[model samples]
Target: MSIPSLLSRRAALLAGAFAVAGLSRPGLALGAARANPVPLPSADQIRQDYQQMVDFGPRLPGNANHVKFVDWMKREFVAAGLRLGPCESYAYRRWEPKRWSLDIIDGDQRHAVPTVAYFVRSQPTGPQGVTGPLVYAGRLNPDGPASLPDFPKGSILLFDAELPKMHLRQIVHPHFIHVRGETDADVLDSLYHRLWTMPSFQMDDLAARGVAGVAIIINASSAMIAGNFSPHASPYKPKVPALFIGQDAGDTLRAAAKAGRAAHLTLDAQWVEGDVPQLTAVLPGESEEVMIVDTHTDGQNFIEENGCIALLQLARHFASLPAGQRLRRSIVFAGWPGHMSGDMPEAPGWALAHPDLMKRAAAAFTIEHLGASEWADVPGKGYAATGHNEYMNWPATAGPLNDFVIDGIKRHDLLRHAVEQGPGYTTGRVFHNSGIPHVACIAGPNYLLGIVPNGHMDKLDADLASRQTAMIAEIIKQADRTPMADLKGSDSSLGADPIAGTDSSKRTQCQAS
Candidate 1:
């Protein structure tokens, strides 16, 4: 996808690294029970580590960058004195780039130009040329934007990114995003869900209205830009080809159709579909319980350079940390296979099979977009990806991704950092949906440029990342050695690893030395 116009297209330079947070005394809550409950990390080092991950760029799953990312991370971990346990790795899905262009000839009036756009499978490519009568299907819904003149079945349809911001109620009306909840009344009242919609659904809705080729306005919704609408479409696939037009370039297509010019389209696409291997590495401790640290190793196929940068970068940081910090609870780092074009609607096959491992895990941390300075507010709190899949049963929801800023704010104790976030309902919805007790955090939008790496390129506010990582490092730093409680009810559907469900004979005291 093209970098947002608001975001720097050129990875420009800013000044200064993140200002380091000073460490005061640890919170005095331990009664010979907990080991200094809260320990401040070496703020300086943590910042440097964060900057390195930011250099990786956006990680869109199911791309070649993901593969390279796995390689880089594994090597880094090994060098860091961290031992790699068995990786629970596999690939389940894939997609390739499809590009298109148009040639318009209106009697004597002729115009041919590129359309303003972004691609789902958006990647740099040589454009193709074709000609046909344009069909203006208008926006996504009949109640949506207006339809263009001469809009007909089997004709090309154009869309605009400037959707009429609807009440969150209209967005979650099952027809839009299919989100229904009891407490999101406040957020629903405020948010405009039109920013994000399934490409396939938008295409199909147009198609159902008797339109053919689809041209969409490709603005990566400022909120949720995690692309790949294949999952929503996997169930009932759409037949028409679709493409995105840049907002600036869309005028050519619109003008041609408006002036009654012959509308032609050219699509040059290579849709690669199959199993692309994903990587998983683990560091096992003697404990039966499990704790997971995971991230998607894949990246955008278009911007292939940044493929696995974050995955490998983070992996290296963890491995380089004190190997002595290995937890007794199995710590498995999972590289999720299908983030973009994935269709494991049910529990991951691996997760479904190993009920025992999942049952044993005390908590999980699935990493995505490693560190962004800002956070979107959660609608509320709940877990997704629960162990019990049947009926309305989800299991563990006590992890970082379920509550994105959680580990950093709560576990890592980045309080002031948490205060900086706005209450935009984002990733935690999936956590609650899947019963995965987790937190989901993406890089803060432009606001955090100085606080996180790539925040101010010259400034490179990496210090914040370092402090955050150190805080997390200290928390996971003692997992294996920490004392774990065995209760009757525990949710363990965090990752696909079997270790999530390991049960111990009795209570074990693991003191992180």
Candidate 2:
């Protein structure tokens, strides 16, 4: 049997009876439901929801597919008996980079340095399609993460992965950043259009400092290229060669910079100004402050798995859900695009706006990966990011799969899985790394699936994921009976979920088969 299959077989033994007698000690609230609990959402339903998403062709940021995907989402939420307020965020145009590239020579060898470029309003003014001598100024601020300080006018940036995270940190800078991982095909195919807003440094701001072009390196995951970027909600236009390049190609530019030689760069990208309309779908609940089931509506331009379609599946499930079963906290089936206008708003911006909502949120479950076979358990329900929300604590295990993560998230239950997986595995590599929207403040700090997966995921079944969601729904139901107030309790309690202790490794008693 295949590894996935054998693993699935093992998981079945551990979780099978859960479906028969109960599932993972259903974390339901005592007598929360008026009657025998309403049946939760189902797998066939989840499967159908996901399959629909796969049908939309690459839901790239600027395409019509993205817009339509959003419309369908809003409709699903509306059908689910949600009050549907002002569509929580949509209708914004982002600039996309058209022509872009870089040039380099190492050891007497010359080749056009490949790059995935960005669109800056004033940076690409050196006349598009123009090839000029590239200037290498050596590394700027060597102590800083991969980056060069000042660039001679009309020079393209060539830096390494060590470059400070583009939008995540603070840096006073100007230089057409040329990342080290893009290639000619990535540009010709117009894949770079989406990333024009990532650096978040303003073009005019950089231009005043003699900035020319920008490039970012995006590594390849095997043969497939990671999608360039999402649309920016910002109104600013970017200028420069917003380009991406492969790792090896970017090194040449960095080498030239290190040697203090003029590195020549080539420009082949053009800026096409226009707006691809965005869409939104809302599933309403009983509260003014809402919890979003957010996911990007756009799909990878060069990949499969319909992102928007998968979101729609969830929306439909919400719609099919009886009003009483849906949690009192609003669940917006949020649909979003994938391009940035160099805006600092961050991914899933709508959800980040409300402090009160983040504090009181029963829980928020963000879903991704519509089809893969690693399906397993969602995390605990207590995983909802608490204070200033960021990666609060590592759950300690990679999770029984993804369901446990989902469950842990919805219920804020972070304890159960600790014994199964070790610390590094839980917080994996660190807190912020495993999760993107992490607990913002660590000092006083707090804080904190599915579908089309066979194997281990299938072994537990989609019901496992739904069970988690349902458990959360139960928890939320329990909270609804209390005063509409702080989740941390009156005195700012440490949260209901306790910090779990480590469980010594369990030795499996194996019998020779």
Candidate 3:
């Protein structure tokens, strides 16, 4: 769940009554049409893919492992009978954090602390590192430096990274009528836009104020660390170093700041440019209409590797189908290069880059964060341990598919272990904005910024993963049979405007989960 220092983007399933589509659709009534039964996703196969991805080590962008993972994905798609376009090659700068350390120095007392490396395109901080007095700055929003009181320019700027509480209420205007906007594309966009801007807005303002360096206290659930920043999207080079420390270290640093103490921080990192791969594949169906399936292929560990496996499993299932039994809508599988290419114009995400192709898509599905172990925020112990799949949705339409998904979970008897309809983010933004119906299956808690590493591969629940994969497959099957017209009105305001002609260029650049 880490972002590149520059471009940072923060970062299901059911079973079903066999041989039946959603109750909403009567055309495909039970026993009326015997469509080939969609093969259920296999837990064993998912486990094998997960293990294989882990064996490649962290798939950091531009690294050999990252390239190898890309190659592996290409091979897998081909083996599954999917066809790919020439791999979209993109070049960008990345950071390599070789070593680093942080400590609070108060007169005669020195306190050592652990650090979560954050990427920034700045000059190297040699072995000696930088030392400066620490200044405490409270929560800073996108409004910029104006939100803060006067502070020492040369001192290190410290802040807490916590998103404010969300109070969602319907927005009504005094003069204009407020239509039912819950499922509006603009609503989702606005919500995500705020999220995607928080880190950058804060960082840019601090940099503008000319702070010597920056440090954040980990303030979320899970003792995990998040370090994702994208240098590719930032137009200005970082003038200061930045890093994150855990809750305990944050408490120590806060104490030091309150006592007017100086701190010594060493950042051992460098910036280098190299090639990273982005992949797109197509499995043509019987009709001219299409459906897009996408997922980011880069991350710290299992946070997103689980997703990659889910995508692979879906590919295998579809490919196994005979031509006559294949989906009625064309399926496009995209393994996008995360943070490496940034997003949009500077580095267009797959959906944005292929506007013409996406225009043909009746719907888009983004698969992400499958099988993360369940965790709870303890009253005093931070995050407590448990186990199960996390299902969050931001569906852009209401139809039989949603009902089928919920019903499938129940039929499989996994409802108690699942959390449905929680707030989630995905590449669904692209299709949603394009006036196409968007659906996403996001599992796991650590999918967000404060992501902690799963317990060395055992925390992921393979059986749960199987259920989520099966659930998504069912949704796709429903969408294939359901007419595109029915899903279009989930948000009617966003008429069928091609994404290329819309304001997608203005959207935030993110390595969506």
TM-score of each: 0.57, 0.47, 0.72
lDDT of 2 by residue, 329-412 (tens): 444444444433333232334333323333434433343332222211124522122221111121222222222333444454
**Candidate 1 Cα outliers beyond 4 Å, as residue runs:** 1-63, 81-93, 102-115, 118-129, 142-154, 160-199, 202-212, 217-237, 246-253, 301-326, 344-350, 353-356, 373-464, 477-483, 486-513
Candidate 2 local Cα displacement, residue 231, angstroms: 10
| Best of the candidates, TM-score | 3
A best-first ranking of the candidates according to their TM-score comes to 3, 1, 2
Q: Pick the winner on TM-score between candidates 1 and 2.
A: 1
lDDT of each: 0.38, 0.35, 0.56
Worst 10 residues of 3 by lDDT: 10-19
- List, residue by residue over 117-163, the lDDT tens digit for candidate 3: 45345444677788888888875443434456567776777777653
The reply for model 2, stretches above 4 Å from the true place, is 1-63, 78-91, 103-128, 140-157, 161-227, 230-239, 251-315, 321-483, 486-488, 491-513
Q: Which is the better candidate, 1 or 3, if ranked by lDDT?
A: 3
Q: State how far residue 23 of model 1 sits from its true place (Å).
A: 38
